[model samples]
Target chain A: MAHHVRTDYGDSDPLFPSKAAVFWYAVLIAGLIAAPYLLESYYLSQLVFIMIYAIVGVALNILSGQAGQVSIGHAAFLAIGAYFTAVAQKYGLPLVLYLPLAGVFTGIAGYLVGLPALRLHGIYLAIATLAFAFIVEEIIARWESVTNGNEGLMLPPPSLFGLKLGTEGFYYLCLLVTVLVVLAAINIIRSSTGRSFMALRDSETAARSMGIDTARYKTTAFALSAGITGIAGALYAHKMSFISPEMFSLSVSIDFVMIIIIGGLVSLRGAVFGAIFMIMADPLLIILKDQLPLWADMVTHGLYLPDSVNQAVQAGVSRVVNAPGLKSLIFGIIIIVFIIYEPLGLDGRWQRVKAYFKQFPLARQRSARPPRMFLKSERR
Target chain B: MLDFTQQLISGVALGCVYGLIALGFVLIYKATEVVNFAQGEIMMLGAFMSVTFITTLGLNYWLSFLLCVIAMAILGAIMERLVLRPILGYPQFSIVMATIGLGLVIRALVGIIWGTDDLRIETPFTDGVFKIGALVIAWDALSIIVATILLCAALYAFFRFTRVGIAMQATSQNMLAAYYMGIPVKRMFSLIWSLSAMVACAAGILLAPITLIHANLGFLGIKAFPAAVLGGFGSIPGAVAGGITIGIVESLSGFYLPEGFKDVAAYVVLLAVLLWKPQGLFGLNAVKKV
Candidate 1:
């Protein structure tokens, strides 16, 4: 007990721990930069969509994950950013100039929402944001003078000093912006402000006791989060070349929340992971739906499958594949499953797997970390 | 004057239906401390079930209505036991998300089972109208009122007089104490869910003839949130009052305001109320434990 001990915790300090990690990370970045050249146009487009959603997902993570504030109306901000940029572009502002301006404009709107949100918490906050989203949608549809009403508005391809960017050029632009936003978010989450946010998330009273100004920080988080999402919206609108209120519905807001939850709540990296998962989810479901019948047929090949069984299987497969709300149904089930069983999400599972491999020689079969259990509220 | 009276009647009738749905929210929220986001979808499915039972299955209207209620109650019990019970101690946000997801799944399932197209369910009382002085109220509207009043009275009597009802109230008030007192707290929650679903089923049946059965009918649940909020989220009587208030407001606004204001009028009222008084008008201000 009295002997001198040498303890080393230096290995956990930085993101890139060793030279190998740095080199591999560099290689990854290089690959991303060169992706458009290697991949087909369709795949590249999917990547662009991923980057756009990733930006929104990261922004949402700041509010919901880091700050413990839930919003189901994030699409309203996206709509604002899209419409703001669209409107500005109509008045001759180039995409380059209007994009940042959209963020600022959306930030102001978020701040206004945050002001009222200060009075609310949890479920009340959620309902208020939802109502706000509905109101925004109504305004967008009814206020035809500005939004062009339900017919929606179209924009010219994004240009910089009269140079129009093609699909590949736009992909690089989205990639570059997403990278910058990611870097900025990492920086923000590491700063004192970020810690304060986490503190507020864990316990408002405790954070207050620590002399953190909960009110100012909460609204600032909202402003910053909304601003980033606004930028994503601007990118989305430009990418689509057309925008409508219908595109950003309550479901989109729910999708953002799902992204953070599935990505691993309270982790920056999880945001990106979630974006990739979300972007690819619909296609994955389609593939699954298509394959189910093939699998079923294979299983029943050696046996005498009745006409009724065949008809039933066909009907079920068609429902899965072609049902109008199949995507939503799948998304809902995923949310429920993830929240109940795998609350730590994919990112959490990834960490555990990594730890298991790293500790392989001396590792015990059982995980040291206990599964997250439901925390009954202590309040009487 | 006649137009005004007529709007008032329709508004009252609509508000009662909303109140009925709002009551579902109140009941579940009171017992479980979780809002059933699928309340509207439950209503939509109930309407679809009744329509199928009557039109497709060739059952009498009354029998179909009764069967639909039973089915919905069973559905509610299954949902509470299977889906919601596992994550009882999770944060409120996760539970809310689960409910939202549940709503989506239910809506989608309803669409797959019953085609996406809207279907009219004709009831015995759809063709008639009653003239009371200057007001020419449709029989359907009057029936909605009658059904809602009967439901409210039944709920009140059940809560006040029945042992099971008192046990449910006790459970909501203090789960631990109720558990200690030999009450099955979990069973109470299951019963509350079923009861709430049954009321919503009744609302759906009454609402079917007027609105027609459609998947989009679930959106009515969203509007009813304001009614629940306006009434004080926890109080059943407050829910009814809030529903009436919202109904009157929506009716009057639709008549007087610019088009589209009617859809969002309840939210405006709700926001104003939340801003001024965080606790709903009838909701008791819960003291925070420091």
Candidate 2:
């Protein structure tokens, strides 16, 4: 009932100094260590947020990518985790105890939600989960009894073994937690449970006929997915030092999908890649918003655009030019383009590029075969 | 008693907008097998266009309304052709994501163009209020009821008597079979999409007089989704019934029950309906070929 764990390590040579692998590892490792030092604390904080999202996104990949389920209301589970941590911390629960308790709270909620998911598959299950997301969000927004409604509750600083952890400590906590989560996810996918999830994904009918407890496995997958995602939410709230319903909106749920899709949904490396890319985009786009107009003037007026079209093009430049909304428009277009051209997502393309380099000499000897296999694999 | 009647009437009127939007949801779902979550955003954008027609372009409310419906219809056609058609053979999950993404893009664009502030829709028909037997009823609630009944009747007539409507229904029923039978299924989808957007715009126009026109007005569309589900996803009549039921139930619940529960009443009904009968109130039962 297990998946081919060797799928990940199939092409990965342990001995050979593959040029692309070395370059990617070197870049990623250096960037990860250097990021906190190179960027301002505010930017580092943004990166921390991105990493938290990456953790949730990767966690969700288990249910979505591996289990073949579409969940649009992931933020509800996120809120449960965040609010659990916030409440526990508020009521004087110790950090170590509260964190695990937060995970348990969300895990049970996920399991409960997944119960209905047993009967419904695909789109219907997605909508039910989405509805649940809405329910939770509204409760958080309106339930003044516990949640503090729209205003949200404040969280006290986390303490462990008599040390008050500040923002820097929280950032490091998020980073360490995310790395550990990614490593755990990678290991899980290599384990039997991960294979069963994939088996469910490939064909639930086959998986069922093969004596897999389809209902139990599906629900368990969701619970497991929620466990990791909820922890990410807890970490996110702890980092922000506050918990609000607005933080876990429908849009935030979509952002997780964007990260997973762009990162190549099925890859373990995608968790890190997605975090760094999205983290960079977080600040880079803000800088580019101003620089784009200037850069446009410089590049278009001085260099690329024809004299006739340049003025017209500059005039039609949209209303939300200053806000992050324009970047959103571009991001939407990029996603559409990505879905159409590179549906395997960025990691899929990265794999192709890696394979091209890794197998350059031998594959160059028979280049036509690789391209054919590529076209076939990408058809879905 | 007056408060009760006023709330009931107003709730029913607002429910009609949900019904109309739900109608579009059912139509699109029937034709393309896609539950467009972006339909509300489409309605919001339509309202903005209608506002632009009346306020900016200096037209009468009736003329502006008709013109905006046509414009919305055209936009819908373009969307069906440009955005949706390209992704036709892809999985339903991706299609849902794509439309949700499109909704975001549209919402952002609308916000940028119209600013975040709410706009007043000065429909002259909404200028008066009347009282009946100790009940105060606004012109808005009355107009919405009349407009919706008229629209539903007209839609029924169009679908029943028209060739394109029958072809559309046939296409929705069996795409490959309809194609084999010489039906223009592709054109039918475009027509359905345009008609769907037109219906959503109708709701927007109806909704605008009662409420302010803004980016946030689209939130009603989310509420209407449960209405569609509570009815059959495939049944036109069921959509209307579902909307009215939700509206009345929500109004009553908000009045009698605890506060936040009203927000979830539609879903409560949905969950109940799903548990009892998943195909919805009017949906045809399907026996899957194992």
Best by TM-score: 1
lDDT of 1 at B276: 84
Q: Taking chain A of candidate 1, what TM-score results?
A: 0.93
Could you give candidate 2's per-residue lDDT for residues B1-290 as a string of tens digits? 76677778877987888899999999998877887878998999989998888888889999989998999999999888877777776656677777776777777788878877889778877779887767878888888889889988988988889998888888787777788999987788889999999999989988998889988777788888878887878889899988988888888888878888888877777766766777688877753332
lDDT of 1 by residue, A261-363 (tens): 8888758778888999999997788788888878877656546688788778777777766788888888889988988877777788777777778787666
Give me the TM-scores for chain A across all models, comma-separated.
0.93, 0.84
lDDT of 2 by residue, A6-124 (tens): 44664442322355656876687578667777888888878777788788878778888888877888888889999999888777888888787877889899898888787666556
Per-residue C-alpha lDDT of model 1 across residues B182-243, encoded as one tens digit per residue:
99988888999999999999999999988889989999999998899888788999998899
Looking at candidate 1 chain A, the ten consecutive residues that score lowest on lDDT are A1-10
DockQ for candidate 1, C-alpha atoms: 0.61
**Residue A216, candidate 2: alpha-carbon lDDT:** 87
